[model samples]
Target: MKVSLFITCLTDLYAPTVGMAVVKTLEHFGCQVDFPADQTCCGQPAFNNGYPEHARTLAQRMIEVFKKADYIVTPSGSCCAMIRDHYPHLFADDEVHQPEALEFVGRTYEFIEFLTKILKVDLTPYRLPEPVDFTYHYTCHLRGLEMTGDPCIGLLRQIGNCRFVPLEKAEQCCGFGGTFATKYPDISGAIVRDKVQCGNRTRAQVMIVNDGGCAMNIGGAGHRYGSTFAVRHAAEIIATALEGGKDNARR
Candidate 1:
């Protein structure tokens, strides 16, 4: 299938490797992945900060940039949620853009959601060179997507030589609500501290978080709190497993 990569602002600026990992993983599953260089921020930060006009400007750019893509995939659940959940509402009053906005939402899928729901790609054939114990952090934006179960955890379980430890209060927010972390540092700090403590309790080698914002917030908190596990994106783990396994599937 043809897939276009929507490298979200956080992933583009702070975690480019996560974007690369996503491409690697998708290509391994026989997808023809391409990056649209014209794509920019999904206006999530501005939109969340109550700047609708500025956010709409950026959203319009995104709508036009990836209009031809058969599937728009991104590593960050937060960005996917922004496009899928908020874009329509942004253009609700504009009859000209509302239909385009809805089409954009329908074509976009967060990375894990694409893998488990659309591709249904079997990860059983992949194995890691060494066993890794990992737990998942369910980013708040994922709730916006209305996903039913823990698809990331399920996919992680499919990999050989990896242990899936249940994170205590797995669905709890990591306290990074885009500008929410900056505007309310004390509240955000307190919540992230609790999130790191929960991950530490898991005793896992790494905590898998698909959203860049949450990962940054949790990683910062983890550093201050001296968290036991490293923070990593799911795509990174999957890419590593695909590369290490004997049945390497990339084209």
Candidate 2:
């Protein structure tokens, strides 16, 4: 299976480790992974901000980059969703890129969804040494995008000896809606505060979010308040499990 990595812009900058772990994890599963340097942002930020023209420009660039890959896997659900669900609309009137846009969307998959659903790779060989307990924050774009039917809970369950504590109102947004956080800092902070409080109430050492934007907001707030909890992306946890990391790894 040949897979192309669509390293989202946020991951490329803020969390490059996530991109590395994704490549390592896929290769561990016996799949050949390629990184297309030509790839850029998936255009979600611009598109969501109502900049269709700008979004289309980036989307077209991305489409051409991975046009020949058998599968295009991305670590970020929100970006994958934007490409899979929104790119078609963005290019609907573009006679040159419409078909290419559809082709790209047809092959895109979120990391966990691709791992568990399409690849169906057995995770029993992966092992985690510590029994880190965490409450997961299911970002809205992931749910709204329908990337995974289970919002990553099922995939986490497959890891050996990892404890997943359920967050009250786990489906609630962490209030980091890309530019939404910047535009409405107070409201975003209030929402993240509530999310951190919920994670703390669960008594979990860490909170895991699928999207980097949400993780940054929630994790940043936790850091500012000196909250006992830390934040991690699902990919990092899974990668750690694969490597048999420490017995008390939180993030």
Stretches of candidate 1 off by over 4 Å are 246-251
**lDDT of every predicted structure (CA atoms):** 0.91, 0.82
User: What's the TM-score of each model vs. the native?
Assistant: 0.96, 0.92
Clashing pairs in 2: 130-247
In candidate 2, how many Å is residue 30 off? 1.1
List, residue by residue over 1-251, the lDDT tens digit for candidate 2: 99999988888999889888899889878789999888888888899999989988888889889988999999887898888778888888889879878988989998988887788866655557767787788877776466545647777776776678999888778898899999999998898888888888998887877777777888899988766777887788788887864333344
lDDT of 1 by residue, 140-230 (tens): 8888897758788899888888799989988788899888899899999989999999999999999999999999999999998899999
Positional deviation of residue 156's Cα in model 1 after best superposition, in angstroms? 0.8
Which model scores highest in TM-score? 1
Assess the local accuracy of residue 232 in candidate 2 as a C-alpha lDDT between 0 and 100. Answer: 83
Candidate 1 residue 19 C-alpha distance from true site, Å? 0.7
Model 1's C-alpha root-mean-square deviation from the true structure amounts to: 2.3
Q: In lDDT terms, which candidate is top? A: 1
